[model samples]
Target: MAIKMGTGDLAKYPFLNEAGDYLRQSGFDWEELDRPDTREILERAEERLRTAVAGNVYEKLDRYETEILTFVVTLIMVKSIGLDPVLKKYALAEARRAEKFLSEDLRRQSDAQRRALFIKIFEDLFGLKIDVTEDGRLFKVRVTDYLRRSSHFHEQEWKMINRLVQAGQVFLDADETVRLIRNELAILIINKVRGMSLPTLPNSLVERVEQMRAELTPRFEYRTQVVTEYPPCIKHALDVMNRGENLPHSARLMLATYMLAIGKPVDTIVEIFKNAPDFNERITRYQVEHLAGSKGSRTKYSVPSCEKLRAENLCFATAECDGIVNPLQFGKKRANKK
Candidate 1:
């Protein structure tokens, strides 16, 4: 049976097709947004962008129509600004917001509603179906679909070999299922926003758009020269990220710490990760900054030792690495010899 989403559901998930239908039914006019009466809509749209850029979740409004309209307006503003980082940031934030609500609904809603929402979000939107286990404590997805979605996750727990698979299905809990859907939602929003081509914005939105561009534009000084001294493991990590593949979490930590150890700017390291399929600029920036000792603990991180890397299956050591215990020591002896 098809699930019918009400205005409340659409408000919580404005990226849904039903939300678009709601907008069309409401006869929302872009021009009408210029009037003072619609100022709240514009303000909420700006707030959405501001929160997204700040790496925080935007609070949904009390009225469902207003929430839906602000989402559309937010997209228009993001499109108008024409910044890839901002677009990605906004999409990720929106996806996370939806994920939060979905988690709440899955936990609190009646059994029938929860199941319906699960099917509506996963099967209807993402074309991936999940079945509840006989005990009803876990969900099961086909191995094919599981691999397709889980590939985006860098955590070891999400790895197929670590999962419990029976026959053709892989088991997941409600939280895990929702987590996978979050990635799908983010990608869906990113593609949708990228494909939009907006006309000239009304005068009311022009100033706010300029403000967003000024605030969100990255302005860090970074080295342009390519460093050829990267060790094999670092090179492999870079290659994986540059190829838009998911780098394992441990490898990613090793790569970031190694780059920081070699004096790479946080912005530069963050830029390198832009090619990653699951890159979220806000999270990347935060993690890179944390490793750089600019955030948290205030203690800079160091590259993992070669022994640890080997244990993690991240080492690609050659004869050149014979004397080095840490990645930072890779070219030390060679450089000293020269």
Candidate 2:
């Protein structure tokens, strides 16, 4: 049976390795249907991994890069909703705590030493001078400008970067060396970028990496502030995971929304009901009702009006609906729609 995962495990622990070995060594059937790389059109993963490995790509990454990749996808969850601790702080603080869970060599490294190592490794990655602040441990660096100016908005790239960071961190914990992890980082970075069929690496990408490296300038900046953390989508996934439904959370939620929005209440109900043999009508009704709350449960339930949508921060839906004058916004058409 699969083990239950909680927020702490999902966020703190990595979901990697072991599977390939199990599949090869123990005769486990690999699910070909599931894929880590979604951008198949841009880059076929098999071709890239081979080339990246040949380049001696896996050895030279710095701590930060590896840490980022291992834990990158979590940012999506974080961005979708708010994070429990605003990331800038957690990034620095947890770097230490995570080590116990990190290394197979857990006998050594007391908490004090770990904290010191956290500060040292963090600073080394993207250099920043640190100071303890009244609110919490703070590091002064321009994350705002970084976030705005950076091209990291793309989900695919975000996953790649985070994966590298995680790997580098693990290597650092195992070995007491503070060497640049560029090669190890290259393994991930090259593989991910290779996934793309971009004709060339934009000069701008190189420049931005350089600029960020400068800002990190011999130190990583960490701070605790009221920050907008997590994405709406990721938060939704966590919420759904808590429900423990057999269907993937994302699939179920998307289906629920499209079904409700397009005027197929019974079909949605029948579908979800069938899936959720343990379905709770009250819970289902609560979710549907709470959304566009005033509307009753009916075929023509009131789609939120333009003004209502705007006031309620529904611009994304609001814009789509404007054109929707909603044609074929229903039943069978949906399977063929998106």
- Please, what are the lDDT tens digits per residue for candidate 2 over residues 30-94? 13213444223112222222222122111212333223232332222222222222222222223
TM-score per model over all chains: 0.80, 0.24
| Candidate 2 similarity to native, TM-score | 0.24
Worst 10-residue lDDT window for candidate 2 reads: 52-61
Q: What tens digits encode model 1's per-residue C-alpha lDDT throughout 90-143?
A: 787898889888877876777678779877787888998878776667788899
**Native-vs-model 1 lDDT?**
0.81
Positional deviation of residue 160's Cα in model 2 after best superposition, in angstroms: 27
State the RMSD for candidate 1: 4.2
